[model samples]
Target: MFTKILIANRGEIAVRVMRTARRMGIATVAVYSDADAHAMHVALADEAAHIGPAPAAESYLDGERIIAAAKATGAEAIHPGYGFLSENPDFAEAVEKAGLVFIGPSPRSIRALGLKDSAKQIMEKAGVPVVPGYHGDAQALVVLATKAREIGYPVLIKARAGGGGRGMRRVDHPDEFADALAAARREARTAFGDDRVIVEKLIEKPRHIEVQVFGDRHGNVVHLFERDCSAQRRHQKVIEEAPAPGMTAAMRMAMTQAAVKAAQAIGYHGAGTVEFIVDAAKGLKPDRFWFMEMNTRLQVEHPVTEMVTGIDLVEWQIRVAAGEALPLSQNEIGLSGHAVEARIYAEDPACDFLPATGTLHHLRFPQPIPGVTLRVETGVRQGDIISAHYDPMIAKLVVHARDRKAALSALASVLEETEIAGVAVNTAFLARLVQNSDFVAGKLNTRLIPRHQQALTSFPEPETRTMATAALAASGAKFAPDAPDPFDAISAYAHFHPITHRRAIRHGDRTRYYAITGLGDGRFAVRSEEENAETLVLPAEYGERIVPWPGHLTIFDGPDNHTFQLHDPLEQAGLAASGSESLRAPMPGLVKLVRVAPGDKVKKGQPLLVLEAMKMEHTVCAPHDGVIAETVAEGARVNDGTVLVRFAESNTPNAGRPARRNIEPSRL
Candidate 1:
């Protein structure tokens, strides 16, 4: 193994690579931007270097700065963790030319697969089952549209240089083709600096199954089975699992062979993933799959593969980079158990899934259960701001169990017990999805999120009875001073002792009264006059209370607590502030373009502004058919909920529809 290596990335993946390097007795050099000066990855590394400013283009993507940092720290090799410069062939070649090892596949191999158009042709030559698409070099829109017609409707317009779902669009029909193509090209140009696109036939009910393959300089390559990443949102993976459910022996063999062939064809070395889109409308088949693309580096979901195969892929990366052969043959590697990984992002699921930013005031995971370790890979800590300059991902939570059902159950419970504060997250949403009957049944596909949008986006709208009960319990505990504790009120009323305490609680559109009958040990039992009683329990870690009698509500724990927060029914409503005059930016970003001028009459839902953050463009629309009084100029920086514009009420009441609001969203 090398004595020292530099991580040319930030966030959790940098921390992840550093961890494995530490275990292997390799010192790690971490590079950070202005926003990540105090990042967890920097603290964990043996040494650190500042590359540039907060913007990725100035720092993480600055190949020269990263190379200089590596050389300054005496790192023998550079590990470009999955993003930024990971797939940049020029950077890889530069590293090698500087007499430093690029701990991944060579420059030639990356160049071969980095461009989607060329990679498809290569896959076709290798008989790896390329997706039926137009990978031609024609740049004309009419030509591309003609190719889309040949490929049929519901075609995917994908950027030739895209990954992570950026610069991709799905057109359902011919009418939407041109607009989608234009938007895709604009985003492709902005994201990848390439407006070229390829049209592909969109498979119905597709399951994203990717095989992990590793190669070394000795002409040795081995396949590490597959991971099912069908659970996705906006073309990005949400949940992933190893040894795909419902996979057959024949199908697995064919995929494994194809993956091996793809790697060997490019003389690939180190860890790589060959992703395939499986047509699941008719279930699994040996030939019913098409190549999606190859991730030319270690994947975010590699932990699932590691949990099942009991092999450290990072170790293999290091070994291969050190000029070693493959560690194990394909037959020798056996998948032990089912593993599932849930990406925990700092994002609001209810607010168009916009990325959220805040300091992590509190963060903790439930203790791991035996045989099921909950691994949290993160590069931030309490009090660390989740900067809008980078990915909203806070951590990756991975769990392993003997079976898929067991793993799913374990993940569900863990998600609920996870305590995060100071920032909104998708934890509750993830918990609900894992507990969904359809999800538990392995009824998965790319459309899973769309199919379950109602359940996933509709947060718990608890009934008044439940809300009142909780409020009374929380309020009673807060009001009582020396009472044997208001929590004791639950059991205080024996079947005969009739003492009822009234409390008002509001949930949704109605407010109702609840009579509390008992309270003890942070538990309260209450019932509406016409409903049955219900008991509630709040975790003790939040705080403890001891009341002698009723004086004034004395509180113990609540949202103010460090570790836990009661599920506030109005939290979502508060976050989704809608109405009236002002247009607020949904998250921190720079105003990219402004279309409406002051005093301009704008129609409801008309695009008035665009904000670029986290590598994506979000258009802000007019809140109503109103005269714009003010608008934020283009290229201005704004924070979450920052008022960018104000509008005069529309002259026509509820013109065409209810007043629409524009909330520019942040990227994830």
Candidate 2:
């Protein structure tokens, strides 16, 4: 066994690996980039080393620098967690050449399954059924287009070297194939530096099911059952559950057998997940599932597998890397209760689930609750920044219970209790999704989110009590960001006798007025327009009912975290505001392409430029028919709210455009 090891990753996965290492009495080393200097993963390591700058290419993805850090720290081996260099065969080979153990599959095994086309061929040779697709080496346009036609309409063009939904596209008709293929290649080239692609038949009502398999150097392999990742948005998984809700005995037997066969075929070791696409249009059967691809390392949703199987996957990875045999036979491994995991992200669902980035000024998660095994796997603290330099994931919230119903119920409650500020979050969206009728009943698929987007994406208004709480906060009863407590003297602001005040708060599109009266002794009477006066006591330091900062305050509500603006009277009377028009960046990103320039005439919704951030691309479009005055140069790094394109001085045409408010920095 290794006395100490180095983790070649960042964020939650790194922190997760360190936890297992510490528990096993093994020291761990962590590597960080300039952006992650104060990150949670770096602080949790027994030793740390600096890699390079903020860009992943110069830091996390720099395999040589990572190996050097491992050697300098005297780590016996290196664990490539989930992303970064986890599945890179060249990096694995280099680590072996450096006289250190690479705590994962051998380079040969990685190469066998690194590309989707080759992996399909290998799986077919091993008798593991693969999805029907064009796995050819042809890269010409006519060749791919002909293949798509032969496979029929509604085909999927996927980047051979991509994952996490990047460099993938769906074409519904023959006319759409060319554009989709071009887009997929562009994304693939940017993300993986490989533009090769494969065309596959798009399955209807597809339920994504993956089996967790482990192998050892002794050629012993076992299965850890399966997880259903059907609930998704934009081809990215949103919610996952283990022991697929409607799985049958016969199907489970067949899937597990095939998974073990695939791993054994490649002589795989350590952790691996064999993903499959099931045709749920009918139902799960022995022959309905087809192998999609194999992930050569751990997945982001590994916690759900651990919850149901009562196993430590990270520990298993470490032990297997040390040449230990399989811990248990296939028959000894059994599934217990159900487990569900929801990815908590800093994103806004209303705007098509765009990822958000900012400092986490105030963050709160749930504690260990009763009757549920809760695991909050995260690498971010309250003050850490969810920067654009990396993924915007905050944590993975996992819960296990006796059944799927109980598990879903518990997960809903936990999401409601989660409080976050300074960034948009998908907490409300997740809370609603768990209680969704189809989701609760397990009628799941990749289209679940997109089909029910209206109900899931619309943010609801605050309740009466929540508004009353906000009113109390704005009254400055406990703490205030403006003047000191007026109740202390009651001279000028309080009118010397009946201390009364009125506040106007602006929400989405409307403003509400509240009448407040100071009742003394940390109490206030607050009344809205339609509701009667309600007296509520303020907890010490105002509690978490409301979070007040410089210019705004956050109120926790059921449907959303309602942050209201208490506008200053002087500022409102200044002017109607200059309405100069310009297209600004929604978040910090790199300008990938620029299609418009000064004096260029563009139509509404015309793609003017593309901004890439967090591995997702969002196109900045013209708001209305107008002539562009100036545009930001291509290849320039920009921050949130930076003007990317400006309209001519007298050519401001915002027809059919909604009023612009404060732009929240978010993901693509």
Candidate 3:
């Protein structure tokens, strides 16, 4: 094994790689940008180096800088974790040229599968069944349109060089083909710097099943079962499981063989994943699966595979890069139990899964149970900030059990017990998803979230108990020290009668007045507009407030953490009037395009600007029909809630004409 290796990435994946390297007695070096100077991964590494600024292009993607840092630190190998430069063939080649071992697939193997169109052709020739699509080299508008029609309606236009759901679109009709192609190309160019695309038939009710394959320098390869990544939102996997719920032995064997074949055909020599799109409109069968793409590096969902197969994929990657043979043959590898992984992201599910960035005032995961297997893979601390410059994934929660049912139940319990504050998160959404009847029954597909939209996306109002607790905390109620019993700690016997205090608290969209009365002897009576008065005992301490806000309180109510804003009398009076009209950014990001100008008329729901953040684009629309009073230009950096466009509240149209829709920005 190599003595020292540098991790050419950041975030949880970097920390994950370091953990294994450290355990194996290998020194690890971490490279960071300005934004990640104090990042968790940097603090965990044996040595750290600053590459460049926060922008990935200037730092993480700067191959030269990364190579120099590796050499300066005397790293014998470089492990490019799952994102940034991990899948870039040129970067892999560059690492080898610098006399450092790249701890992944060979550069030649990466180039073979870098482009989707070319990879499809290679798979077809290797006898690995591929999806029926047009993978030709023609890059003309008419040619793509013709191919989409030939593939039938509901065709998918995917960027030949894209992943992570970027630069891809689904068109259900011929009329929408042109628009979909144009949009796909634009996003593809922005994301991958490649405008080439391929058209494929869209499978209905598809389940994403990918097999983990490993290879060695001695031309030996083996497969590690499969993972079902069907639970998704916006074409991205949200939850994944190993030893697919309803997988049959026959189907598993066939898929595993096909994966190994694909890997060996490309001369693959490291960890890689062969993703297959399964047509589950019927049921999972060997013939119903087709090749989607091959990720030429370690996957984000590799933990689930590790739990089931009892194999250390990272350890194998290092050993193979050091010219070792395969650790085990295909016949010897077997799965023992079921494992499930939920990707906990700093995103608001109610806001269409918009990525959120903020300081993590308080963050905690549930402690492992005695008999249950629970693992948390994260690279953040309590005071760390989730920045817009990188992916907003907070952690991966993995649980293992004897069967799928036990694993799912344990996962749901773990998600509920997890606590996070200072930003909106999808913890509640994930808990609900795993407990859904259909999900529990293993009836999963790519459309699971969309099919259960109402139940999964609706944010519930705070319970009465939660509100009462918030009110008491905001009113400065504390436990009295000179009490005979613990229950009487909050009761001050100085007053013979109960003392009443009124305060206003805001929870979501509504603010209500609550009357809190101290009954002395550690008891208090609370009354709110929506609930009857009730007496309750006070605990010595409420939850802590991680943020520096004076009256803001983060209280744990059962499994969920509720953050309530204490109404400020002085600041509430200066709020904007109901008639005020302005379009503000919902999150901090760079203004990619502004479609309107001052005095331009716009209609309600008309897209006026596009903001790019967290590797995704969000459209800001006009909330009402009005004329633009002022607007910002494209290429401007803006913060969350920054007013990008001001509008006149008047109902009259500008220049006696309605605004044209041709210039409206596309919806994300």
Highest TM-score scorer = 3
Ten-residue stretch with the least lDDT total in model 2: 658-667
Q: What pairs collide in candidate 2? A: 355-666, 355-667
Q: Which digits, one per residue and each the tens of the lDDT, describe model 2 over residues 512-595? A: 788776554445556766556455444425554577755778987654689877766675444225456676677787888888
Candidate 1 has an lDDT of 0.79
lDDT (C-alpha, whole model) for all candidates: 0.79, 0.84, 0.83
Q: Give TM per candidate.
A: 0.84, 0.92, 0.93
**Comparing 1 and 3 by TM-score, which wins?**
3
| lDDT (Cα) of model 2 | 0.84
lDDT of 1 by residue, 1-668 (tens): 79999999998899889888999999999999999998889999999999999988899999999999999999999999988899999999999998899999999989989999999999999889988989889989889888889899889999999598888989998889887887788677878878899899999889999999999999988999999999888788999999898999999999999999999889989999999999998889998998989989999999999999999998899899999888898789998889999998887777667777777766776789777867887778877888788888888889999999889989987887676766768887888777778778888788998798777877655444335434564444332324576443444545676355666544323445656654434444456654564544433223333211122122212111111223344753553344345766766788877888887988877888777777787777775577987888888998777767777663432222211134544223
Kindly provide the TM-score of model 1 when superposed on the true structure, using C-alpha atoms: 0.84
